[model samples]
Target: MREEIIVSGRNNPLIDPLLHVWHWEIPVYLFLGGLAAGLMFFAALYTIRNRENNYKVAVQIAPMFASIALILGLGALFLDLHHKLYFWRLYTTIRLASPMSWGAWILMIVTPISFIWSALHIKSIFPNWDWKFEVIEELLEFFTKYKKVLAWIMLISSAILGIYTGILLSAFNARPLWNTSIMGPLFLASGLSAGTAMVIWISKNHDERKRFAQLDLMIIGIELFLIIHMFMGFLASTQVQIDAANLFLGGEYTASFWIFVVILGMIVPAILEGLELKGYKIPIVIPAILVLFGSVMLRIIISYAGQASRWLY
Candidate 1:
């Protein structure tokens, strides 16, 4: 009777029955951060390679997206904190071993660079295009006029940020659903897919369209591999992990996991990328949009669902 009572409750259906566990805040952070980082990296890549008339636009837009992610990421962190005022305390000290500390430091470092980079490009909009306004451009030009170097640095940093987002979740060994090392790569891959899709949607011209199409295929392939590994963890892990998997695969959260994550986020993006590869462009755009939105929803569901299931157990 005690066991029966333990598994059944109203609050248990939405939150951890233990009351200490809330919604899946960490997972949500991972998702948004990955998407943001990925978008910034890829956009930087394209800007370097093409140097299209719109290179300035790419620089401007990518940072804006990244900044949005930073804002949302910080908000999520604040919400997760039981005492919001102590949020400043995170920056006051640093712990190398803590993934949260690492993430905070990374965000602190990357966001400013991105903003300055974007601001440098903004001078292009001025009619005179004077060299006086943006000092960073002068510095960037002095060390590396080649956009590719910039792209590579941005790519590497974004990849680190993307993987770090996953690492944050995996660091929590107590959460069976998040303990898998696979989460880091999986999050990085999804970040790429979602980020590339966002760029494709926002981009203009045949060159961008064609280039992003190729990128889409590559991203889809990576995302699929990550999904396979995620499921492999479920198959290979202990009972607690298996039980957690069931929550995503067959229980109350099944609709969200399957509908948003598996189908809309992954499969549709694959199909769309395939169509783009086959020279069908229009067919690909809609699915790209779906995948972007679905990616966001996927994070929300996993975060909430994972915690909710803990309550049941």
Candidate 2:
């Protein structure tokens, strides 16, 4: 007689025939987290280069957005938690191998730093703003005194946060759609591109807008390149991976991915920025809005599509 042992678990809950776990909350959280990371990254970057004052929006304004985005993102994450009361247990220990572990700690560290940085600049953004709380003033003063150190820390933290956004998705090796290392850089590029577009929109100075537009344009180019490479990698891999790529290439996500994410989001913005650089009167907000819209949509599509990429079905 021949005896055989059968594997008990070869199925996926996410890509089941009719069971979907995550909802809108997850994609919203991811988009906002990436956006906040981008804002903080650029804010710290300008401060480190001593160009913060020149780019007032980058330093003063963006941190405020970052702070708000972090709060809202965390709120969205909380809503998606199956065991909401047990969420704090994530802080009890660190797991270097776990992407969720890294993200939890990174988000905790980043949230406070972003809020404090924004608070420090409150006076600068609003001259008439008055709060005479003694302890608060002292804390802000201390943060201001060592702001250079804070900026450096923020630069590193923000970069990690931005990369973490993608790593969270890609680390799920079972999800063939997001199983590539390129997701890290691709998401980072998307975040930086959105951040730069916001800076361009907020800046009142033509030269500042122009400089950031050039930077945004360059990042968009890099983003497109990475996207192409991601597809090439997928197409060259296994059948499941190729099926995953087809989701965006010519499958269900074809129109959404190509039209909203690729064309309107990156290409149109690139064209608008180029025209602006070429002495045309393109409204800066147009490109900025398109970039931001695309960023959020990309997260939503990726989050949803990844869940559908498993071969169990």
Candidate 3:
């Protein structure tokens, strides 16, 4: 005799359970991408302005970090790909509909530009380095001569790269939490904030550090507003969107979402920076470290929270 087994659909949740498709590499990539874009953007802006302090950390050291950060971020992305050996296929064709395609092209364009941007400052960075190599001298001379043009290109590319980081996640309509158009601007603001904090951390010039600290405070304010608006938009959206929003508000990710991202990441950093701006001699490193750490946590929380969200029940 054969026995028949039946499965009860009614006992299961309405929608398929959220799958953990993405992992730590993705969020780390996003955070580093944003940081790199921010550094490049600020560096280009300072170059264009021909600021007297253009050779400061923001313009000099930051671009080098931008290049390094982007390389690491791309490495993380490559590792996340299942077909790592076939990664070259991404360049073989253009798919307008695919965010991954857009990201790959953007990174390809941005990476070389970032390296060239850093090369422009190589002479200033390593004043004692040997310049006997013709190739190195020529590359340096070319970048220095066309610095303005390169700065403009970097400015535009940085903005695109920063916005692309957000759009990459937003493109996933399957995750309502990441579907909002606001993600682009929000991430851009966060990137600028984190980048500003990073420059502040490494900057030796007192005035420059103060200026960046003020800028970061404003960016943090904007980020906070965007966060509020994001949740408000979710509340006004469909049932699926509301359910997705709850994943952060009252679901599994609630504690880390509030503690790590909202409080420690944005609010505390804002207060610390604010105190410093108010003539209080707070340790700049403290806030800078908090902002950078918060930036990373924000990306991690968003990545996991988005993965936990779904459009259907």
Candidate 4:
């Protein structure tokens, strides 16, 4: 008898019919890290917005965390590139039509803007009283004069960063799991949720608690609505799309999607925010940590599973 053979290559029918090579781990890491950085940017922006100086300490510290996330995100993005040497060419050519290209450009713009804004804001808090370099003094003075501009840029960029990350995933229409028009808005809500949650959890001062709680509730509601819309859209989609949805809802990614993303990221946060809004402070900080961890895992699972399955009927 002839030996039986098992084939699972490009010619296999059960395999992904459309083979678009992916750099997987790096892209998913970038997605999660970028959103985390964006969330921190929003946290900083909110501190300035509320005219709350007590919150400034947390805001200042947040950018350090954001900086780490952004650096790791950029590193992942760079690693995903096949030709790392020609990466500079992306900056030279601005293609508005391409979301990946546009996202790269927007991220590039936001990162430095955030860094400068964070630096100026920090300088405002810790003023250099040394009578050493006149140039440094003059520069600091200049920054003080345009502090409002920096704040505005920071706020606007936070918004852009929040949505841009989702748009980056939605750009791939072939992947029905990520092609939701609601994703951009959903991402913004989730970013705000994570951002405000972080600020609240890290806050030493009790004065800003109410405002952070309010922000958390607002973001949670919006996120819930967007998730509903996303699911509805998916359920109403074509066969291929439904197949894609199964990959998350009932397929391989079900556990992560339900446990981490839905239960922890959404449900726990909503309940905690609700209690917070009702002025019930029975040590609600743990839920905030849970939600933050859930948000990170959600990004990883969604990015990974959305592209992991085969779409053949």
Best by lDDT: 2
lDDT of each: 0.71, 0.89, 0.87, 0.69
| Lowest lDDT 10-residue stretch of candidate 4 | 12-21
Best by TM-score: 2
Candidate no. 3 TM-score: 0.93
TM-score of each: 0.82, 0.93, 0.93, 0.83
Q: Which is superior by TM-score, 1 or 3?
A: 3
Winner of 2 and 3 under TM-score: 2
lDDT by residue (168-263, candidate 4, tens digit) is 778778778888878788776777677777777767666666677777777777777787788788889887778878887779888878888888
What tens-digit string does per-residue lDDT give for candidate 2 at 127-184? 9887778899899999999999999999999899889989998998888999999999
Q: What residue runs in model 4 are displaced by over 4 Å at the alpha carbon?
A: 1-50, 123-134, 276-284, 309-313
Residue pairs in clash, model 2: none
The runs of at least 3 residues in candidate 1 whose Cα sits more than 4 Å from the true structure, single-residue gaps closed, are 1-28, 46-60, 124-153, 281-284, 309-313
- Order of the predicted models by TM-score, top scorer first: 2, 3, 4, 1
Report the number of clashing residue pairs per model. Answer: 2, 0, 1, 0
Model 4 quality (TM-score):
0.83
**Which tens-of-lDDT digit does each residue in 169-286 have in candidate 3?**
9998888889999999988888888899889998888889888988898999999999999999999999888987898788988899889888988899899888888889898898
Cα RMSDs, all models: 4.0, 3.7, 4.4, 4.5
